[model samples]
Target: MKKLPHYQAGVAVVTALLLTTLAITIVASLFWQQQVQVRSIENQRLQLQKKWVLRGALDWARLILREDGRGSNVDHLKEAWATPLAETRLDEYVENGRADTEASDATLSGQITDAQSRFNINNLSTDGVINPKEVIAFERLLTNIKLDPSLAAATATAVANSQTKKTTAPSGPSIVTSAASASSVADTSTATVTNTTDASKSASNTGQASTDAIPEVQFLRFTQIDDVLSVPGFTSDMLLKLRDFVTVLPHATPINVNTASAEVLSARIAALSLSDAAAIIASRDRAEFFGLTDFKQRFPDKLTDVSANDLSFATNYFIVAGKIKLGRSTLNFSALIERIKIDTKIIWIREL
Candidate 1:
């Protein structure tokens, strides 16, 4: 009986050890899981914080643009909006006037680019019709940039065809009949009237409004250069090179002579050589063109072939890019702003 008690004691000790081992494993697993959850929450918090900071930066940029628009009609490199912010810490923006304290360790830097200084791709069409002149100018730009000029026609044709597919009436018996009847109209005026009627009927059938009644037919606008991926012959490499000198805007934007590069100026004027473009840029620095007359005097008979509607001394569109780094996370913000009269509005914002 005494030997049986000793054996029972041994069994009790083994059971106690096994229970303790299981308890330790459960506790360790719970602790590890808690740590993982805390880390995930911290990462999400940081991401949210980064987004807020970028939004604040965008607001700041819009304020600057508004102030600039109120002060001057012309947007030049010398303007305050044109100035690039250096990489700065979040603490510097604090009202306490103390750096390296209180605020989190975040760095930011950004620049505002003039979107109107470059050629607008939307200008290739006026009211959905391909402009042969604009196509030729684009060809000249491609030639100047040492790319294949034939790509211009290919790009234009693609854009035009895409637009036509969107707006053109489908081939049908009624469409054929209308087309034939409209073709039979003898005089130009009668033909115009007949075509307008058919267009209205076609628009009604498609459930789209007829733009013919409007004085100006709205051309398609592209918000980003990447939107041109559908264009034929516009490879990524071609877009990269074209990006520096071309822009896609919601409306037809004229080239700003004060801000345009030599290539743009040369392409804009059929007769202007590279040396002439350089001269115009240099002269503008001395005395900026206050009016079209001043522009004429500066370039003298140089831009006779260029239309007055093709040039502008002021800009209305601007792009603001902001970068924010918080903790281990970084955020990039890009905004497109438009200045109408004295009011400035953000057209769109993109985060990268």
Candidate 2:
């Protein structure tokens, strides 16, 4: 049969199948793209919600700190702010339906620590000048931590240099050279070489104009305990050892006797031994020092002579850290709070 040319019939069926397959593929791709967009939006919503919940937690901590300040003048581990908040469900803050029940599981836990518990590195210097006594204390701290005691001088120097703004000569020989050359009308290649040489000579003898000679080194300002690494002798291991016993505050502050560790107390008091510091801490545990007089009286026979100038029984700085776990995601947050006369201020907040 001239019957419907068999080849053409087969071609038509093949063409139809190809068209159907392509259409199905395009439809599936469109669906996938739409699903991805939906998930992206949901993820953004979840991030926003989580941040809000964290903010609320920080606010709660602020309130607690304020109340603590109002109730007492001293900061100790037995206080309410020191008590950690256990991991508690946060369903009221975030819905558990976004993810499977397992994924939706949410909880939060946190605690506030007295920042003054450690020796504030800022204490090493006063008004841009290193304090000899403070430096000695820092030296002791380094020695106690098994780190090179010499780092104390370096740290103090760094802090001192950063705090004291000193006039520095202009940097960049090239820039100085170029400026010097620009002063002369030397357009020729030969003149360019001569000009650069002359500029180098001028720069060698305070060549950069008085205007250019400004404070060039306001070196790196240390804001945290980790900044100690910037010093030449400090290593990560040394920092780990010093971290619990050291701190960096905005200004010079006395070490808190009620909260300071034995290492810190020993470092603060030149005559005090490590064992004596520990004994003082043990005695403090039995009863928190309500005042400087109280702290001295409560300690053993030797501690009565301890200088109260560099010692404090009260705390003004605190660090609050917490974690919020929502199913597959976890948010770790930290903040520094300053308490001023029954009122507290949030110095800084960060996500860890």
Candidate 3:
């Protein structure tokens, strides 16, 4: 039983320290691996929950469409559906896993349109020629609502200026003979002048244009509404106020009086006063105008300017939006939808 040398003792101490360090490193590595595994499991669980929530939205939409009985083709994907999503409470559905007897927030929210309506400004630039009716309608819209007088004038001037730029004929145009060409040019000029004069006259008739004028540009989309910023008197504040009420759709769908908001009705329907628009919205809470006939009955006086041919009850476009929260994650998605009737079944047309 002899005692170990001092040098040997030092070596033993160093070996003990090294082993202790190795053990700690192994324990730390194991702890980190366990944490990673826990995180992975949590993420998977959240993803599944999100999927369920999304499925719930789809099912809710289907149920609403079925109840409406507007045909299976009711455009459930439109903004009307999304408007209610944010306001709906999901507690009952999440807790019971079924629609409850009490009206749920999710149920109520599934009914309103939230997306911006389309205004179809592409017609304004067709073959580089603005449709005269559209021009008249647009000017009337501006005038009907008493939009910025300067903006109206500027837009008119821009349109007129754009129309006036003339293209010169080729120098060697002997193919059709000069006399015929001259006659064609004279007729063309006369038609152009007539159109310009007619548009001005129509604007005057509608009381949409003033004798005095300014300069401005027409917009075609929500993003392009900002183009008014380039106009001399259109302030950013004014454009912001107007953005929510306007849209540019791929094709024009006349405003449905039943669905049109106060802003839209005021701008597009000449006979609808702001008070009238407010009354319509108020009436919607108690009973919606189920069809154009119903709307006509409600506002018989206003119906004079709105023809039966110009009204619609069926809507083709929709916007669907979903918000999901699962565990620690939240997600939001929005989609535009179109209703297409195929054979006997209706289909929702989605972009991508």
TM-scores of all candidate predictions against the true structure = 0.74, 0.80, 0.53
Give the per-residue Cα lDDT of candidate 1 at 124. 81
Candidate 1 vs candidate 3: the TM-score winner is 1
Error of 1 at 203 (Å): 25
- Residue pairs with backbone overlap in model 1: none
lDDT for every model?
0.78, 0.82, 0.55
Residue lDDT tens for model 1, 166-266: 35668854333566566664466587889989988898899996465654343344558776767666788878988889887777778888788888888
Off by over 4 Å in 1: 1-25, 92-103, 162-221
lDDT of 1 at 63: 88
Better of 2 and 3 by TM-score: 2
List the candidate 3 regions with Cα displacement exceeding 4 Å.
Answer: 71-250, 283-287, 290-294, 300-303, 307-310, 340-352
Per the 3 Å backbone cut-off, how many clashing residue pairs does candidate 3 have?
18
In model 2, what lDDT does residue 160 have?
85
Give me candidate 1's TM-score against the actual structure: 0.74
